[model samples]
Target: MSFNHPTTVLVIGGGAAGIMAAITAAREGAAATILEKNERIGRKILATGNGRCNLTNTDLHLKHYHGQNPKFAYTALTEFNYQNTIDFFANLGIMPKTETGGKVFPFSGQASSVLDVLRFEMEQRKIIVICQADINKIKKTDNNFYATCKDGRKFQANRLILAAGGKASPNLGSNGSGFSLAQSLGHHIIEPFPALVRLQLAESFLKQVQGFKFEGTAEIIVDNKAKARATGEILFTANGISGPPILQLSRKAGEYLQKQLKVWLKLSLINHLSTEQLEQILLKRWHNQPSQSLAFSFTGFIHKRIIPAMLKAAGIEDINKKVSNLSSKEIKQIASILQDWRFQVTGTDSWSAAQVTAGGVAVNEVNPQTLESKKVKGLYLAGEILDIDGDCGGYNLQWAWSSGYIAGKNAAFV
Candidate 1:
């Protein structure tokens, strides 16, 4: 337990959380070492926010997160909120800015820069970094933890911080191995699944609206109850729905489906507009182009690519029909469909397509304030390895920062 031993702290997984934990532990006068399984650190971070590196979010409330015990994040989040995250990055020489919906990113607008700051700080703090350390086994003996990598190298330290991320985007190095490592040490894992992922839908609309992108609101209804909603850019993939709003809804949709509950996606293409307003607008468009085909009438109002498909979904299949022939009933149907398009959420995209993992090491087994294991002394958990997952707009990264900060601080001094 000597702080001056120069090898007192060891952090597994050189991800967002591991990097932060190593930096803090080393700076707090403990010898810190980070063992990353990948060839490079922060690979997943480079792909976040479409390469802009959303480092944190302004919204730090518990509701923005999901877990068996979402409230478990309160202590760590309060100890190191978004303000502390901003200040920490500022101290590391990263000027940050927030975009719409409070997603915070470095002023450089490059995820590489975020990694750069973290790497630079780690180097300045003299934190030992070992990349390509694909650890497979961790054991606790006496008062020390020993880690054995698949490559036969061994790591030993007085304290161990498991910041290894969950199984999401395996190419980025989260291959679910961390769960095995934690489970080996008496940690209960709550079946890990994909989060912040796109949902696959029936080909009926997907094939027709593929590649069509728009701004809209998406709601997740579980067992006929609205669970969550988000308003942002929505994109129709060749096989499913995507974009921020859809991604925000996908987590809950997948969770409910896992529990055998009925889940559906309710989308409002004409967000913020009432049914009356939408109907009036549709009527005006038809009146202005009385002789135009149904397709032609909606051309200027909606994307031409989606007009036919939308009309078809609304049960108005004749695209060649003249707008002037539309009765009040047809007009109302179009408006209603526009405002309340429903789709069955078959399932979420694979883990490779997910931005985060929803379930991991259960929360109740860890200390809320320090993130230390209640089952084993000198062991801690942080980041996606814990059960907590957050919204797509940088809330996940914020959780990493908060939990890593708490775990690192306590690991070094405790």
Candidate 2:
């Protein structure tokens, strides 16, 4: 059968990374074509940062990223650091605003604005963009590669860049199709799991606590040992727990939960106070208001909506009993509960709710400097499809920018 003639480069997947790669290639004088399986390009990108798109973190460190080889990101990150990302966007006409914690959002705080700029850039560069095209086959010949879509359309290129994202947001068009493509091309893939997803618990009381939001610290313990911890806003849901703190712990939670290990969360409703310190602080309050009931005394320490639940958890015999009547041991128990309330994690909310996928193409198979495949020449990988995943905030987005930039620059050179 006759096939399409080879072009300079063929970049598959039109999400964040794919678009960036395509734009980079075209700007370097290479004819680039992007084949997207979705109806529109960058659908997943428009859903990022709660629709505002936290494009990159101004302050990024190696600690923020999680992977089998954490150091694998060192080269790409340095080559296209946060400042480079800021400059890239600033040149694209999208003014980014730094919010609390170095999280950068578009000045309009709309994810669409970021997408629009990328779209405009790709258009100006005159890159060929075809949507609603699903890649069915990829074959490497002696000198180049051939990609055939399910629609029987064939594309040939000297270099291929796979920016098809991970399986996290299938509704946004990343449904593990990229993994299938990579495996077909002889790549070893790490088992993909949901990351940055809300957790589900077996506790029955969560139904009553659903919809309640609290500011607290959550410590993730594996087999009763403290493995990791984070402090942020926690939200109780009908099914389980969510919010920033829970999402921060989800990457580890998802991994350990798969091993059938006991994953527990020690939630501190109060921040930075040790159990002993809390006990002493509460004792002072009790002595200062001897006639006030313990329930009345704790109103200032906790949210009014959760005070009754806190009292119940502490096993206070009388809500109306004066604090002065409470024994020393009883007051300490209340402080302990506030300082170290714990919950068990049963599972995650699933890929639909996951912000980023945990695992993808193993980093060892791809060169970090250029994001090129070690097993195959003229092939590259980037974005969430790689095994690298970052913590909450703008870490994941930063990876997208860095990896995309490297892949694009290298693909054009090839």
Candidate 3:
């Protein structure tokens, strides 16, 4: 039942990073092999950008990336860059198109197209890919690295690239097992947490406004101070709020919640209007329909489902009361609530619901220039397996391509 296959470079985890690493190594004239735990490679890539597969972003600034040592990503990001990503895919027959927020996708607008091209390139290069390869142990001795699977199968290589992803979206293949693999080789882990996920709030009226969607700004307030903010579409779930803006703030909220600090999400439902402007608008509307019930007053303003919950939260208990009876103070309170609807953040959704992982193998333990592990010679780490996780909108995949190329190029020579 045991077999030993030798290659010049062996890559674990056939996700975005692993696939790129193997391909890059093969292009460097080194025989490369990929070990994937799933039935097929790039399973997670299918879920990116809601299946459009954001390849990379036009905006490649350092501000979008997050990690213990985010600067560690500087070298790889600059070396490969977004232009390199577009060109790389262009050469692979993938026509790149730029969308809003500098997000890039294939011209076909299909994630399957992206995977198809990557698979085609791997096939053309004759790269070996072993699916369902649950590597349980990895060790290096002399100049060769050995990886053993749970089924007693073995693989050997001169250089090993641990491109296995972090602990997010286990169904798509990553289960945080890469942390254990890297730790086995004396690497430090930064304690992975769910990122790009929904935040569960402690508010009791969430179900009342569930399914309500709007364009607004979301801010994460930790210990009474605003930590991070994002403005985009926001969604209300049965137990919490979500959508792009909320997901962007989930990382900081989760981190603060891990410390048991008080976390709150302040949502600016009417972000376009100033507080004074909102108050004046409400007054004008009430003046036009002075006899209208408070509940029906906002019929044309916001979602009807949210009106009751929002009014209750703003301290307006008598929704049946007429608008004429409302004092000036009550109108200002409603305006303030519309501008800043605060909800206590209990925690974030589980990893299965997360789009990416917040932390991973510490980047400092690996050389930024080459992505080679300082603890183990010839051991390269890339992708979500490293601590580098980027903001939504193709940044994470860009990191994958950048680090994978660097790791693969360096490992090929090693």
On lDDT, the candidate that comes out on top is 3
lDDT of 1 at 148: 99
Q: What lDDT tens digits, residue by residue, belong to model 3 across residues 1-414?
A: 111333489999999999999999888888899999899999999999999999999999999999877888999999999999999999999999999899999999999999999999999999999999999999899999999999999999999999999989988888888999999999989888899999998888788779999999999987788899999999999989899998888888888887889998998889998888888899999999999999999998999999988998889989989999998888888999999989998888898999999888988798998999999999999999998899999999999999999999989874
lDDT for position 192 in model 1? 83
* Superior candidate under TM-score, 2 versus 3: 3
Ranking under TM-score, best-scoring first? 3, 1, 2
Ranking by lDDT: 3, 1, 2
Clashing pairs in 2: none
Q: What is residue 327's positional error in candidate 3, in angstroms?
A: 2.0
Can you list the residue pairs that collide in candidate 1? Answer: none
Cα lDDT of model 2 by residue, 263-290, tens digit = 9888889878777787888888888889
Of the candidates numbered 2 and 3, which has the greater lDDT value?
3
Instruction: Tell me, by TM-score, which candidate is best.
Output: 3
Superposed on all Cα atoms, model 3 deviates from the true structure by an RMSD in Å of 3.0
Q: What C-alpha lDDT do the candidate models reach, one value each?
A: 0.89, 0.87, 0.91
Off by over 4 Å in 2: 1-7, 284-297, 315-325
